[model samples]
Target: MDSREMPEPVSGHWPKRSSDAADHHPHVDLRPDGVTVRLPTPEVDWPSECDVTLARQISQAARELDVPADPAALQHLNVAVDALVIPEVLPFWRALLGDRDKGPEDLIDPHGHGPSLWFQQTDARRTGRNRLHVDVSVPHDQAEARIAAALAAGGRLVTDQNAPTWWALADAEGKEARVATWLGRD
Candidate 1:
């Protein structure tokens, strides 16, 4: 929630954080072990809708202890994830967000209220661990249009049996993304 939407505690005391926007700085280490970690937090002024979804992702991971997190802590935190895809994934998500293309190789939420995911071009196919990935859900009728849009932009189509309900899709380099259709539903 933005400062406006953050509910005050029953005691009516909220953290005295300033009104300045949060900066999603990259994690780096000047320490001896040289360990670095990016802490995922909500960017200030983020759209409530996007923040809500990100909070759900954070909470899901937190519940499984996959990541030590507090959804509440995400308030005013700026978090960004980069996706190095074959360009096609960008338009798919842009369309999903009902956003116009931001640039030749990038798209940003118009409101500047959501985490900025940078989609980059890289030659290496995704191997063992993905630093980041993306997924989407679309109506069945819109699936082909979505895929076509992605392909036109630079994405490739893929399918995997383990995931039966949705068509598996990937970038031209084999880095995977997904499109699940809301078809035959209640």
Candidate 2:
């Protein structure tokens, strides 16, 4: 079947693009609760040390809000965690990734997603979050339509950044998400 017959989905909406075209759009949802979560945009000037500090900051803020930051909230990423591949999880994911699993560290998604949803090993784990998150990116022209599609797919508009060419989108459960349209690597 042509890709048009099987367009990829963001969250749950049927986006208006071929599966190949959707690759240029990446959406990562940090949905702790399974359905909704807040989306976190990549720190443009990302530093290795930031994850730890950011986790701490989120925890402290959660205390102020009377809601604790579940370690899973700070741990699990909707996308691939690290470039390193765990042989343990690779086989299952390999089958899922199909021909894309040509090598370790190669990004793979059975769903025609943007990047390899890396499962970075972590120490802490906790209950799921109340919100779901997604990182979405599409072609410049497809940006608005893609965002609208996300809204149709049980998503809610969270935030947007005009300069960096990204939009922070979320689901109905207050989950975090991002919509970024950029050149695809694969």
Candidate 3:
């Protein structure tokens, strides 16, 4: 099964100390440690769709929590590891990250603070290529600008076959990464 359709993090926040979007309500959970913004999306099967404007709101909420005003500091990241034999390797990672299995192919930080780790299965072994890449899921609308920024930073496009949804990119060292959005997953 494609896990992309799994529900994203559910809406939640502390009482009297939260800000949320109304329609597809994004949640702003203001905790002592910091603020956790659970961006909302339509009921379709995708992770979550965030609004770029929400980032500013989250930053303001973070400041209220006594954190810095840096937007990058509030971003969430996840890692995707491509493997041919998941069962053989999944356990080692589950033990290493101390994360709980969200599904047969995914793990999440028990603390809600670490980037999610997911395993993508491959049909045949590919040689001389990195098996891991970063899956940076940002607000759906911010994808193109982010892609452009990477290009400006000397990262070259690997493939855009999945573009407007996800772009495959390679860094100066040829390491691969994907700038993913919630566009096509719907």
Candidate 4:
């Protein structure tokens, strides 16, 4: 499934269920900002039927409890590190970050509190730009508003050629960050 096909929660909560048919319980994480339900595995682009059903149930439960959902407020943050030799740098970050979970090009926080780390491989050495940047992945519909807010706060658009997927921006001093979405990624 593409980004547009992904199911969204109705009450500002993300619900997830195990792919295992034997596990009937949905794990839910309640936070001050919102609720996140997770399975043993990370979220997939296309969720299973059970996952969708559990998401709906979680939404219903939230509504019953009068929980309001703010789609604009729902976002996931990650740190992107551009490296020419990822293998050489990956170990240091993993050790420094306290060893949670490692993917081929990413490091995820097992507890889901800290932002995930994504390593981008680059052939040429980058100049006049940061090697590390923040990636804020928000709902597709909210990207524009978020970009506008950042711009109004003195940030400038570095590039939007990747819009609907991401927009690179920079602070006054040129520190970079990207507002991204799952759109355009299949």
Per-candidate TM-scores read 0.29, 0.34, 0.67, 0.74
Clashes of 1: 5
Query: Clashes in model 4: which pairs?
Result: none
lDDT of 4: 0.70
Worst 10 residues of 4 by lDDT: 10-19
lDDT of candidates 1 onward, in order: 0.43, 0.43, 0.65, 0.70
Q: Which stretches of candidate 2 lie over 4 Å from their true place?
A: 1-88, 107-136, 152-154, 159-165, 174-177, 183-186
Q: Which 10 consecutive positions of candidate 2 have the poorest summed lDDT? A: 39-48
User: Which prediction has more favorable lDDT, 2 or 4?
Assistant: 4
Which is the leading candidate under TM-score?
Answer: 4
lDDT of 4 by residue, 49-154 (tens): 5544654575565555565556676667889999999989998999899985567778888786788888999998999888899999776788999999999999
For model 3, residues 19-48, the per-residue Cα lDDT tens digits are 334234455555444445555332322354
Models, CA RMSD each:
16.4, 18.0, 9.3, 7.1
Q: Give the TM-score of candidate 1.
A: 0.29
Clashing pairs for predicted structure model 1, backbone only: 42-77, 46-113, 47-113, 88-155, 158-168
What is the number of backbone collisions in each predicted candidate, taken in the order shown? 5, 33, 0, 0
Lowest lDDT sum, 10 consecutive residues, model 3, at: 1-10
The lDDT ranking, best first, is 4, 3, 1, 2
Candidate 1 structure lDDT: 0.43
TM-score winner, 2 or 4:
4
The local distance difference test score of model 3 is 0.65
Q: lDDT of model 1 at residue 177?
A: 64
